[model samples]
Target: MKDPANPTSRTPEDDRLRRRIGPTIRDVARMANVSIGTVSKALNNNGSLKAETRERVIAVANALGFRPNSLAQSLHRRHSFTVGLISNDSFGRFTMPIAEGLEACLADRQIAVFMCNATDDPERERQHVEQLLGKRVDGMVITARRADRRPGLDGALRGLPVIYVFSQSDDPEAVCLLPDDEGGARMAVEHLIGLGRQRIAHITGPERFEAVRLRRDGYRQALTAAGLAEGEGYYLSGDWSEKWGYDAAARLFAHGREPPDALFCGNDQIARGAADALRERGIAVPEDVAIVGFDNWNVMTEASRPPLTSVDLNLRALGREAGRRLIAMIDGTPMRGVSRLPCTLVIRESCGAKTDTLTGTEDYA
Candidate 1:
């Protein structure tokens, strides 16, 4: 019973369904009174057009809810617009921040990131690398939980642009981004010296680690610079754990031996353990023994008795820099050598620094 003059009158639901389908380039061209080619040029900023004409076309496209097809655009540009992120950090302690920073930098460029965790398995890592290669990613970023040097992926990479983060490759020409651990350790020791504490002991991880050696060298350099000598039992090397720190602290004070007035721990967990040990032995923090830690981990630093003052590795910034360098490398720019970014010292009650009332956080770069 449809009337000839008003056959199939549109309903609100019909209009809503039509809107969900979205507007096309042809719709935009018709509304803007321009050709489809002109609309494409305006959207991509590709061809000669007057500024006023470009603005008008763009305004029409925006009003119509027009969106370009990313897959088609990528095909036209001959790029997959994707990057691969490979990590051996199964805990995500170091990988998360770096990934966030990298994503932040690449978001504006419409690049997608594929993350793969290879754990400690060589076969798994190889499989992940092969998959990423099959996808034809524009570039790749490799990171690890530790800051040690790892074997390069020379055979697998096939000349793809790659950057290392929080770790280095054994390859001499590989680009690496890491925190300045030596400089950070020196700053911590110097701060303790400035606080009038002469006997500064270093409690660190195993001697096999390059970081441990570098930090120890920095601690020794600071002590020597201030005309202070390291006593027989001032440097202790053990496993990187709270239990190790607790045991080390007890050994330092046993047998009526002189105790260090300040303790510079390799990590926050060790510093917290040492603090607990000192508390049980009836020693007041800052008044009798001050403590400084590394890593600036919020869980350990903020939960400690006086809140630890520790070195921040600036991992996120390192990731951002890595992303920039990778982009440049993908664009045919050559990058080489290692780059060490400076760390910042977050000041809190642990280091005897007064906290800022407004922010409750202060740092020294």
Candidate 2:
């Protein structure tokens, strides 16, 4: 839903273009039996028009799909009314819904979005940034994998009101919007604890990524809070993909020591692969070895034979918030650094066992 306080929806320019095509003020005035000036006043809310006549004109305009030329209006006012978006390759899938939600919210405010996929390449990202600047976008938002560490971004956007979405690096100067990774990790681990699995192993993404690092931290925190010392051998690092998940799971299963009673995968893709590996080894999920994943990516998790337990990172919210913040920055309102959105746990059949069954699994940090 579009927040009323900030009406900055996705692609404000596109929506305006849709409205500008038909039913000019002349047409509306003709239909309402009023002067074009009256119709203009009614549409723009600029000057006084008879209330009854205004209603009639509005009604006619509505029937005829008459819309104001927001792009032209913003141009006349010396505002680009456009936001630049730079995203990474993996996070690209999330851009659409977020963009859609943003557009829906910003409909009344009249703003538009310009998007670019940087594919995690510094040079390409730099080029895209330059292109957006050339286009005179009013503000910019980036769904960066490494918000602070990206080369040239800091210097390039020094004076621009830029907001980072999805991930943030260690630098404090970056204004960012991200999921509550710690909270999400805690939610997933606690769900496993609740399911009575004590010997839990984690297959995590590359430590270089901030979100992954936080999720790993959250897992350790959860284990510590429960009085369990996390095993040194319990963690496996891998790429955020199903192939890596499968490889890690196989490695764990083959390692001679007692197999972990459960697994916490870094993301849904890894979890899916882990599940396949377990199934291939004839291990029944939840009943034998439980599994939990991050990122509530619905395609695989929701449709799996036995649905997977996962965490919802609120990625769409992250996108929408980024858009809202970008609009604010363009409007000369600087937002606070580091805005975080809460994530929720989604339970399924993956962790079905009772919590008390795992005797040695208490308080591992």
Candidate 3:
């Protein structure tokens, strides 16, 4: 199934728009591998973090030129530079990074964020929107739980300068920012081909997800480009779970002759499952098979025995873009449609790479 999403341009202007003025707690939290609130508590000596963790966080904060006094304090301006953040995702894995990215961009300008979790509930969303508007927040950033337009969303958000993250509105004129899923998937599969792996196969998430279709297209395009599209069943669809990977990989090897030498997974979890299944069958990773995953999630990527090579949708950049776009709109700049950020391929051991090979992110410099 196709996703109800669109893409936007990540041109040089977008990059410059995300550049901000000063350092904030968000900066320190990122440098110290902690949360923004954690940084505050650590600096004030008010929390229960491990001694070493706190110290490390402090050192990192200092190194990054962070000041405790500046934490959550607005710039010396007359107005409170507050913005409302409405998101339907509570898991934080996706929403948190995006929020942090938006915070980073806003923090540069000394803007405070008031976050409201909609939890995919329309009533809650309306309530939060009404509350933010009542508080007279400068503007708002809204994101859907599944990155698709929801009912009453447009109506509830009617008079505010709004920017949509990872989702779009029914209005063709709305400003949205989404990750380039098609491009990211293409980058991953092409990297595998570049590594001299010909017998490549793909296993991805539910067919209902637009990500699944886009990544699959990327995989197929890469294969066809290399004149290797003749293979059958090299593409498979399954649920977005490690168990699906395990089952799918096991079924492929049931043939017991000439299995694929490289596997491209839709997400990190499936990659881990596929790896585990391969290992159980005495198949050596990167020796007999190479793997690449999407999402570039650190825990899953790093925890795998050889680590995983995956795609990073750069939620931080996405959020930063959303914030910048909203600020521009609030400042009387004309904005329309989706502004898409490119995805990056972060290389690790699972691909048998000698060095990190990032495709769509940036130069090594």
Candidate 4:
């Protein structure tokens, strides 16, 4: 029973008492029926306690909605608990889900991330790497898909924990996380071949990139396995742009050698461009020329006039795996330096092939 004019009293976690009755470790310890030393050890992760007791302390803290002061924790451990991320623009599109997964993964460990886009420029990449190093990030995740040579960050990255996501270094010793691009290409080409597309043509990016080389090798391997020859005129080199794909298609048409019944594009942008060029030339897709693309970017494919069939690189899984492996590395757990995730195919209207009926025997082209 209280006076009508009086307001109800509230705990520190609610109402006006929140700041006045400050929540402290000692308070938490008392509420949790634990010793001050026990609370300190549990909060700082400095001392070991019984498993049950540790869990109980954490549960009480959470129940009280206690937020750890990161500054205090950093001061106590002398660790910034921050990770650096270096990326290119393509990686920005392909690595967003992975980045989100990484953030979620690191959040469980109470770590923060600092992301920087270098736009695939060597100078900008160098500056960003240096800036992240200057901040003394605990580790770094590099997603340089187009980085040909080691940038100026190599020397600084030495002895620092690093994980390559969506890309690889020329050096085999570097820790790398990438999807099985060759296998993915094999799946895509084989799918096309199963649709009777023996005269399949490939449109890919500059041959300088490893992904390109691997994908090309897979394509060749699939053709060879099927006893089909990928003729000299069957491949075209173009940049990873829709316009480049369109221009490449025009070049193919100009050659006047038998046009391929089906085209396997390096990526979705190229596929879209090639499709547009074919439509402009009055060639019907699937009926006249079937098409396939990689990187299942829904934003690009879903809204196309005729939805494009593409391969799913599982970028989110790629990012999640990279974050998981990096965490293991930071925890001093033994880990496989290079981890390759799997890929899937997204069936759409562009490819005239049915996934369920194909056992590498059917022919539609």
Candidate 5:
């Protein structure tokens, strides 16, 4: 057979080697003087190869240090087959689910991912961005702790596909995916209203958080939509902790006015705390005051006296969509502007969804 490497000569076999599925496997097979099938069997333990032949192929592969040159391969296919994910959220609850969704899709495409957590530090974020860029990731997905934009993110990922999750991006042309906090909050409040709770109150996280304000707006909107007068202790803002929920409920009772018949909390932690306060005062949950919370953090909700009802942000779906969008962008399909995902109300005992009556025996069925 004529040599494949002969100058000024080209063959279909040679051209195939030069394509995105490149030369390493073929080179090893040729040097070992064996069929590619045999080489594959030896490497993957799939079938069988003669001892001497397998040893020779192993030595050849080891000597060559066979690893596909992604740059050269990508030049042929115009795809790096790699994506980057950057997260500023230290909590695994948010970022991990997103990562899992991204990974599940990418794996089907045989693409790899580079994941980095900035840990909410600016310097760390800068360093991680530089490293990911240096590694030539084809696209990037960023998930942040806040719903607001992050600086330098657009510039760092310029000329490459980028998706923002759980946050908005400063670049108006960038695609950002965020939960509809207002819609979620309104859903919680409306649920309490539907359950025959007239006096509804709300408690949430720090005032500085944009989510806090949106959720507050949602709570108020639901009340207005229902034509129900706002409760005496209409709103309270504090740290997003169980203690905050407890103190807020306590303060509501302390005002020497009407205690809420229902409460909508910003997050599950607050909801759990408020439930604790109600229980400590010999008040039965749902029977006395039905409660609904945001974020639907299962751990916190399940642990509550009567499991808390909360709003699910559909974070996993957000992540799956983010992955799909970035992949599309990488393939030259453009998507810009912020896309908000709606929240679903998850029913549990806290809001009296699984029971007989709000003011009767606590029949769970």
Candidate 6:
């Protein structure tokens, strides 16, 4: 029998069924002593309302276990509240961090992200874009493994907001977010210069890459700023690999010429390879020759003997900024031009500096 004072009380089975059904917006409106529209406004964070009233509605909703129907809310707002992320990073090295950062930024706003990998295939990318467009995603983010300029999407997005992360777009009006390769390289070299290393050599990837060219320019600029001559044989350009680094280091020490006091490698793998080659030659790191690398890749940096001081591109931060800018564009704000985010120097034992010291900051512009 039901208790007279508690008419809603029911058996355990009935309570279980009620729990399954859950509470609705109407329940929240009734419990909060407000109209259904007021509850909708509070829950959806739409329309101006008294702060006290909003708080009360929220509290009552929480107590009643009320959850709004996302489909209904989206229909009312005319926004899918979803974003599409497209990438060509098959290895997940760059895409993963960017996606994580993008998700972190969008989650707070109750927006969802759909990730699609193009794997260097243009047809596949077009298909993904079309599918996302069909789903009516609010915006899209395009990324790539390398920070190179890529062609714009093939489809007519009807003025849909699109952001390029870790990639550049040929369109002058397209928003592109990239790591400041030149600035980062300059910072790395400046750090080595501050250590009083007079003779510095650069070992890097092929000249075809924009990153390689920018980093090379930065290295040269830093050296020139210090009144140091960039020696004829100081720059070695090759494929980005440990083998190239090892061979390049050997060449630097070849021809009975004076060896450099420091080496700035384009990537951590190369730096590790150079360190190994130096080890075989009985040259002590920092004491004899210091080294710095880009990418700050943990697998190579942490594993290297004496570790490695490296430049971190801050990819995650770039992604977060990309998300913010995309949302702004979606909200009718215009964003254009290229924005270069700063890089950080993660100091370890390799450069003879105090271990685990982090430094460097550049404005996003």
For 82-188, candidate 2 gives per-residue lDDT tens digits of 77777784665566656665666555577778878878777888898898887667777776544334432556865777777765535567776767777778777
lDDT of each: 0.86, 0.75, 0.81, 0.78, 0.82, 0.90
Off by over 4 Å in 1: 1-39, 48-67, 108-110, 356-365
Reference-based TM-score of each model: 0.83, 0.76, 0.76, 0.75, 0.80, 0.83
- Return the clash pairs for model 5, or none: none
Order the candidate numbers by TM-score, best to worst: 6, 1, 5, 2, 3, 4
Tens-place lDDT digits, model 1, residues 1-365: 34578868776776787788788889999999999999989999999999999999999999888998766776788677889999999999899999998988888777889999999788999999999988878899999999899999855899999999998899989988888888888888888898799988899999888888988997898899999999779899998898888998888877778889999999888899999999899988878999999888899999999898888887888888888888898899998888887777787888776752111122322
Positional deviation of residue 244's Cα in model 3 after best superposition, in angstroms: 0.6
Worst lDDT 10-window in candidate 1: 356-365
How do the residues 59-177 of candidate 4 rate in per-residue lDDT, one tens digit apiece? 88888877776656666675679889888855467657778878888888878899888886888888887888777677788885543435334456766778887776666667777
- Leading candidate by lDDT: 6
What is the C-alpha lDDT profile of model 5 across 213-283, one tens digit per residue?
98999899989999998865578899989999999988876646878888899999999999988888888
Weakest 10 consecutive residues, lDDT, candidate 6? 355-364
By TM-score, the best candidate is: 6
Q: Per lDDT, what order, best first?
A: 6, 1, 5, 3, 4, 2
| Candidate 3's TM-score | 0.76
Query: Scored by Cα lDDT, where does model 5 land?
Result: 0.82
Backbone collision tally, model 1:
0
Distance (Å) between predicted and true CA of 258, model 6? 0.7
Q: 1-365, model 3: which lDDT tens digit per residue?
A: 22346345465655655454446678788777788878877886876888998898888877877664432333332234788988877877788888989999999877888999988787888899899877667788887555555443555666668888877777777777888777888888889899999999999988787778878888888888988763577788998889999888897777656689999999999999999999999999988999999998998999997899999988988888888877787778887776667888999999988748575753211
For residues 231-337, write the lDDT of model 6, one tens digit per residue.
Answer: 77999999899999999999887757999999999999899999989999998998999999999888899899988999998888888898899889989998888
Clashes of 5: 0
